[model samples]
Target: MTAGSVEVVLRRAGAPDALAAADVWLRSFAAALPTVVSPRSGDDVRQYFRDVVVPFRETWVADAGGGGGIVGVMVLRDDELSRLHELSQLYLDPDWRGRGIGDRFVRLAKERGPEGLDLWTFQVNKPAHRFYERHGFVAVEYTDGSGNEEREPDVRYVWRP
Candidate 1:
């Protein structure tokens, strides 16, 4: 619930959080991935969060208690056929970085997928690579930017606890 002195309440995301979560996702993406081009517009991302992520995915959000808005979001998805649990999405408000909130999100992902978890990050994002590696994830695969919407080279990382 509380990470250090910060009273952040992490909980399953509800429909009401869709908008705020989308905002955080938008801002975080803009701040963290300035070089990568996104195909979707801001409204498109908002609509996706409202229509799909909140209702369908195993979505979680970090609420900055009191009047503060949702500061973080994480989504987990499972593939029953392959038994793969993917950390589909994780992002935080730019201002909330380095506050240990992202670490909490990673811990939750590991707990939710004790068997293992897989995620992808752009190769250019060294900070993300370090963060994921520090959390026990190892780069297992690399792609040449053709498969993803962003057309950016990515590395797949897997974590086994």
Candidate 2:
């Protein structure tokens, strides 16, 4: 899809794309949730992308074609044992919001986990809440900031096809 006038492609992320993917996540997190605290340092998040996410998860990136760098990132986790599929992480460059890129990522996540998908977002992120709800995700549970590192009240959303 085209992000404004620039063409954007969604593709599987490899080891080499870890740094750029993490950068998008960091920037998006900072811009979208300024008041929320991140327990991990930038380096730690980058390292996690390199060591665990890219290697273990179904990681995808919205690439601004022709070496324009990653504008968005999405990670999916499928647990066969529990029959659980999670849209673990989804982030986009702050400048790329409202450009249909996040919509594309959510569509991909739904396509990948056609049976169902679950995700968690801070209750304070009302924009995200609306986005997910528009995509047919329902808030199934809520928790008082105790379980997450951010200690922010969060809600779990689930989408089933």
The deviation in Å at residue 79 for candidate 1 is 2.8
lDDT of 2 by residue, 51-135 (tens): 9999999999999977467999999998675476899999999988898988999988988999899999999999999999999
Expressed as tens digits, the lDDT of each residue in 10-112 for candidate 1 is: 8999999999999999999999999999999999999999999999999999998774669999999996755879998999999888888899999999899
Kindly report the root-mean-square deviation of model 1 from the true structure over all alpha carbons: 1.4
Worst 10 residues of 2 by lDDT: 78-87
Model 1: ten consecutive residues of lowest lDDT: 1-10
After the best TM-score superposition of candidate 2, give how far the Cα of residue 77 lies from its true spot, in angstroms.
Answer: 0.4
**Which parts of model 2 are misplaced by more than 4 Å?**
80-82
CA RMSD per model (angstroms) = 1.4, 1.3
TM-score of each: 0.95, 0.95
Global lDDT scores for all candidate models: 0.92, 0.92
